[model samples]
Target: MQGRKVAAVVAAVGALAFVVLAVLLVPWDPVPGGPLHPPPASSVFTTDQIDRAEDFAGLQRIWSWSSLAVSLAVACVLGFSRLGAAFVDRVRGPWWWRAVVAVLALTLAGRVATLPFAVLLRRRVLAYGLSHQEWGAYAVDLAKGVAVEVVGTSIGIVVLVGVARRWPRAWPAVAGVLVAGLVMLGSFVYPLLVEPLFNDFESLPDGPLRTQVLALADEEGVHVDDVLVTDASRRTTTLNAYVSGYGSSRRVVVYDNLLDGGSSVDDREVLSVVAHELGHARHDDVLIGSLLGAAGALMGVGLLGLVLGRRGSGPADPRTVPRVLALVALASLLASPVQNGISRQIETRADVDALEATGDPEAFVELQRDLALTSLADPTPYAWSHFWFGSHPTTLQRIALARRFEE
Candidate 1:
């Protein structure tokens, strides 16, 4: 017993050290650039914008909290219920097929259960004029999302069951590696495969904006075969952009709303958006994110193995899958803060890169403000909420960062 206690202590210490190292290694400061004048506070937002922002922030908080609660409850139900095992037993198929069916049923059930919250959130988005997608279109998108989830989760469960059956003792480490590899592969393929289902993407026309985007990429040492413009205005009024995939698949995607004058995003704001995405490409943020995800998976699986080993049940045992799934869900929820912390750091660095690459802190500041207003983002989220759930820094923090860059 004393030996076990010592081992636990040592393990805890090691995990703490790893977390500290990760946080410390991340660059929290903006990149160096020439001195520039800071934009006036008044220029960031007007009185009317602030009032609108406050209202939107309150709505977002409500939606975020409710959605999280609903999701957690659903996860608990699926994970703790014997329904998964019963469903598997009722299905007449090979062991793999049985696992697949069980997973699909559970996944579908969870999706159905949480659909009300999804609808509620959508309603709020519509109310705020953030989304223009009709219910019909929304329903179609939701169906597609579920279909993708079913296929992906089914394959994953089958592979996991197979690994467990083949190597009960070694399954955790093996499965961890496999899961990590799949994550990387998924990131590599998502832009090509999954993204197209939601929106049509077309290459940006040869114009000043496109030329400036390509030039920014070159300056940032990021290769670009093309800049794709996504038709996001059909569903959203939010102005946004992103960098996805890697190598030949790597591309910067800008929202059509930003380019088509659906919002207040001007030419300079568009350039700022492109520059920020290019920063992601320049730093290979996708690869780094994949590696982080892989590490987290490895850790989670190892911990899962320890817990299951203590219970004297392996993944090969079909009866144990429900408990395993439950544990995984719990583990993921517990790890979210850490995961989000890493994300925020990466995003902040990308923001810094955007500022440096453009050497236009004023434009960056204006774009950040405009983005928040356009997306109806909360200017100042609750501290605990931001720490635990926020993937990007708060709008206020971003604005502050831009101001600091000017100094």
Candidate 2:
């Protein structure tokens, strides 16, 4: 009977998801194949591209809003009723009580910590240009978003940790402080904490590849750095290499997959990969990205405030505020595709930089081609999906750009 009940609940949830998807995808009006918005003759894609982009945007908006509604409804059903009761009952009595108290305390701590910092950040952004002000406003909204994320996540961690300590038979905490802390504190400290969890990182292994990497950096007038390899294959089959850290910590980290054979990419190809990554670092793309994000956040908050304040409750109305915030967050998430498009542009620029820095456009091209094949990345994804989820330009686009840079 208990097993049947669980299965029924799972089926119901799956049904809800299917319904939401169907509603979003079924368009009210048919989209035309012709030019929706004609652009200059020299643009990358043609009239069909514009038309498809429009169609996808329409669908994306529908999906975004409807998905939020569906998700919130599910959360409410889960949180306030029998599902929640079942969850609460699973915990051992005194420990359960203690865990609940800890969660509440953590939530309150996050709320208290966030508000003033958010406000100050908002005010600082407003002091800048109109774009800056807009971005700053968005930052304030993001600050609240972070608070919500932090508190909720912290509570989950505390509960899990508490449960592990009390009842080892239920679920082991498995990894030690390094993994736990990294998993909990994701954004800023991810590189510092989570990275060390799986792999060992000593200085760049003495090799020809290290020499070549440093030489390329030197030629580009960029500084020399360590080339560290991490055992990333322990967690994933994905082959990746990146340059991380701001100053002294800045180093190239190649996953074990890159060196070994999840993909057949050689050490030479890895060098080219790191060159592109270094291009991003040298260009200060990360810092620029953070600033852009902060600006967008500030703008979003101010806009959200202006719109919601006029029609609905003030920011203090805790009851309606969360709902309004939820809507605002949904809107922000929907806008992510547009941001991703910008990021792809930057990535292309970095590729060009990589070619110039390395003076090896052919090697870069080879590396990119291999990467595309290895990652099983679509050669041509739907423009809208690419805009939303993809940070790098399409494989074709990157190759073409690399050729142009070489020329």
Candidate 3:
């Protein structure tokens, strides 16, 4: 028994070291900076923009708090109460099927419980002119999202339970590999399979803009075949763009709103956006993110195994489902800060790359201003909130970084 405990401790320590080493080894190219300077409020945003941004920021804060409360309440019910176990006990099926049923039931119930908050948030977005999606369309999208979650979560639960039952002692290592593979598979297929369900994508037409985008990719040594324009205008009026997938599956997607001539977005802003995404492709940020996710999964599963061993419960035990779910939820919540910190670093690197690739820091600044105004992003967000939830640097930071190019 002492031997097993010592082994587990050693394994945990080794896993921690591996994760830290992986992060440290990532090639983070430096961006030029002297002192951290906040951009002037007057120059970064107008009076009207600031007022609208503050209103949106307040609404987001309320939503964030309410959402957190609801999530915690749900987690408590699953972890502390017998409701999850009861459902699993009463369900008539094989162990794997039972796990699936339990996962789906909990997921659906959680979604229902949070529906009001989701609806309220959607209404707030509409009021802020951020989202243009109609109620019916929104409902459709919500259903689609729920369906995807059910499928993915059920598969994961079933796999975990199966592995636990098959290899009670070694399940953690196996499950970790499975989770890592799934993460990579999801990243690879998302551009081709998952994304199209949400928005229609079409190749950018032959034009000076397309020409410029291809040239930017070439300059960055990124072999991007085509830039795809997504029909995001149907759902959102906000300007945005992203890069997804890797290798053959990789592509740059620009929002139609950004491409619309009637919109305030200009060619320079669009070029900057494309260049930023190209930077992600050039650096293979998606692959790096997946690798990190793999490491996290390994550590998480190993930890879960140790906890389950302590409880004298195998993963296949239906009663353990609730505990496992609870642990996973808690772990995810706790890890948010670390995950977001890494994301912000990657995003900041892409921003720097964009500035370098375009050699147009002025355009980058304008693009940042346009994004903040159009998205109603708060120039100054609460430090705690930003630390926990911000995936990218604050808009002011981005603007300040762009201004550094001028110096």
lDDT of 1 by residue, 1-407 (tens): 33223323433443554465466555544434533343443456787787787787786678767876776776666666776666666788788777777777777777777777787778888998998888999899999998888787666667667887887656765676686677778788888999999999999999898888888888888888899999998999888999888866787899898998556778887898888888888878887776666656555655666666665645676656666767877777788898898888789888888888888888887788878888877666677988988899777667777878777
Which candidate's TM-score is highest? 3
Clash pairs, candidate 3, are: none
Local error of candidate 1 at residue 272 (angstroms): 0.9
Q: What's the lDDT for residue 198 in model 3?
A: 93
Task: Report every candidate's CA lDDT.
Answer: 0.75, 0.52, 0.81
Model 2: how far residue 350 lies from native, Å: 1.2
Q: 226-267 in candidate 2: lDDT tens per residue? A: 667886664445567776554554566777777774467776
Whole-model lDDT, candidate 1? 0.75
Q: Residue 113: error of model 1 in Å?
A: 1.5
Best by lDDT: 3
lDDT of 3 by residue, 239-324 (tens): 99999998799999999889898888789888999888988898898988877777777677767777777767457687677777
* TM-score of candidate 3 versus the correct structure, residues matched by position: 0.95
Every model's TM-score: 0.89, 0.55, 0.95
Rate residue 243 of model 3 by lDDT: 93
Candidate 3 CA-lDDT value: 0.81
Clashes of each: 0, 16, 0
